[model samples]
Target chain A: MSWGPLALSLQVALAATALATALGVVLAGVLARARFPGSDLLDALVTAPLVLPPTVLGYALLQVVGRESVLGRAWESLTGSSLVFSRSAAVLAATVAALPLVVRSARAAMEAVDPALLGAAATLGASPPRVFLTVTLPLSRAGVLAGVTLGFARALGEFGVTLMLAGNIPGLTQTGALAIYDAVQANRDAEALGLAAVMAAVGVAAVYVGTKLGRRRVHGA
Target chain B: MAREGGALAVRVRVAGPTAERPRVDVDVSFGVGLTAVMGPSGAGKTSLLLAIAGLVRPLAGRITLGGSVLFDGSGSWVPPHRRRMALVFQHLALFPHLTAWQNVAYGVPRRSDGRDRAREWLARTRVAHVAERLPSTLSGGEAQRVALARALAAEPGALLLDEPFSSLDGRLRLALGDELKDLVEALQIPAVLVTHHLEDAQRLAARVVELEAGRLRSERPEGA
Candidate 1:
């Protein structure tokens, strides 16, 4: 019945959602507007995590940031702590797992904007930044919010990657999902059910809000 | 008033997307008045306006506004935002997310009185009553005036309009066209209005240019 795991999970999900939302909006904007060679390939790479097994993604992340790797060594030298099995590692795992939701939703929203509107803005003497800020971004508000909420929900439910990268360290890297797994294995059915129910409630609420926003977008359009 | 200069000169060739169509060439000059570009659908009238607006690049051409070079074939090109050109789209592409006043005020310098200036333009266009409404809530005529107000707020060196009266009925078209022509004349800036309607062309323009299959067919000056 410890609250530590739930608090840590919320922290990881929130941080990961923030990172994913920022990167997703930028990448989505670029992907939506850019016309160049290898753009398709880059898009596929960003989305690969969505289709790839979480364990495989976790394993790949481990290879790059594990304690024996160069990046891990550099991190240890700088921060005097190993990269793997840390709370930051959990955040990274959740971010990678949740990024596709944000990118897909945000890109769809950005692409839905009429090119004619952009042309009108330009003709009105609006610079590129002005057009994006005043026209493009504001028009795509619903989609962006939907993407952010979906990413948060996805990050909250991430288990396989969290286990592989951050491990199940009590009062540390162990998030809601990991704690649930531990509770079930230790035959603590009551604690497992409590955590699982709370996780499901938050996840469902996020999805419900996201769906409502998406519906509102359709009605507005 | 616009700076003193000869007719805005344009001599350009646009390579069509397909080889079968080859190119659409335009050789015309527009003076400080409203000139109507009339043609049937798919005749590239809109393309010509877009080219002048810097939204579409011509294969080879020079566009000079007043004495300033807007574009030339020697890799000299100005991005659309810097071209000092305003376009009122056929569909009236007012920013749906913004109120009529905000849409008109969008390109104004970020100063305290920018909104006041926008309201002035809206009042001039006679859409001040709808200034607080979003484009979606405005009627067709109201939307048209709002779009015009937004364009005029830019104080563009040139104006390009794509079928501004297309969405309205015959009577409404003529009424709106006449009002639009008066606005253009009062501003004394070079303008190109693209339309497929001969009536609109004859009514709104002092000079009418015809395009057929992507080439300029004729230019006739209406009697004063």
Candidate 2:
């Protein structure tokens, strides 16, 4: 009924989606083209979060960025505050949860592009970045868009990681998923159901858009 | 060391075959004219072109274009885009997302007149009518011309054609081959044409070379 948690969730999801999309697309491109030693290992590492339990991922993230860790210390020094129980932590958790989906989908899409088309662009004197921008990105737009949409949906519903890293602090870090959990614990069935319905509707809409975009083929391919 | 004539010289040892192609170890050069490379399928013809273009690293070899070293087994290497060699792929890999004119314009140097130059090349290749069409909508001949136009628009130091006419009907192949001949002569740059057809080799090449099992089997002047 408060709507505050819903607003916080939207904010966290949007920020997480932006960060995840940028990192995911770049990592996907590298994985799609590079064939160096340990490349497969690197890919597996990126994909680890997808199959790993949320609690496991949360524990791993805590080890890397908990209050006593080096990154946590650095952030505290820079920002004059701890990072573990804040909105930023929530954003980070969602980003990590959302990233693998984007990376896998975008990588498959990018790998599907004709190598001959890339070769032709190079022969035309376009630099590597130019070729990626003009040819590779345009050809893979559908997949990238789909990945971003899916990432947003994932970030929106992120519960376990967010609960672990960014504790449920009302009006500060409590998102829609966290709010639903809090409502059920307090025996507020009506509030819990309302939040659940909102989350489900938004999640379904995002998935529908993502699926449509994923199925949309490039005209000439 | 620089070669005497401004020819494109290639002497490379490519690794032996895979399921798709045989080993390719070739040492060949091209002057300011068309030199057709005749070979059988799976004979590593495409590999040779790819190596020369710097798209494939050779086990041991050197490639020099005009007076510049494009590749040396000792570690000197120029990337494909920097080599200034335009290759029209066997499948005519035109950018599907771009219109015909845009594909030609892609290689044009960033200048105020780049689009105009692209239009001129389209007209020159006689695909001006399809300038706005995507590669998928164009007929085979139209797409071929568009690919050629895109290559020539780059004003490359050398031209590499991989089975340029293999997809066309016999009559269209002959006509396009003639047009290609005239274009090569007018451009006066080293041109390498890869074809399995003896007829195409005899018709367009000033000199013809044969590849078998990934090695150069013979080299002779045209009609020899």
lDDT of 1 by residue, A1-221 (tens): 88888999899999999999989988888898887899999899889988998899899999999999999999999999999999999999999988989998888888999999999999888887778877777788889889889999999999999999999999889999999999999999999999999999999999999877765663224
User: B65-150 in candidate 2: lDDT tens per residue?
Assistant: 88899999999999999988899999999999999999999888665666888899999999899988988999999999999999
Compared with the true structure, the alpha-carbon lDDT of candidate 1 equals 0.87
After superposition, which runs of candidate 1 have C-alpha atoms over 4 Å from their true positions?
A: A68-78, A218-220, B1-6
Kindly list the interface RMSD, in angstroms, of each predicted candidate in the order they appear: 1.9, 0.8
Best by TM-score: 2
The all-Cα superposition gives candidate 1 an RMSD in Å to the true structure of 2.1
With candidate 1 superimposed using the best TM-score fit, by how many Å does residue A146's alpha carbon deviate from the native? 1.2
Worst 10 residues of 2 chain B by lDDT: B1-10
Give the least accurate 10-residue stretch of model 2 chain A, judged by summed lDDT: A123-132
Error (Å) of candidate 1 at residue B22 is 4.0
Every model: Cα RMSD to truth: 2.1, 2.5
The parts of candidate 2 lying over 4 Å away from their true place are B1-5, B18-22
TM-score of chain B of 1: 0.93
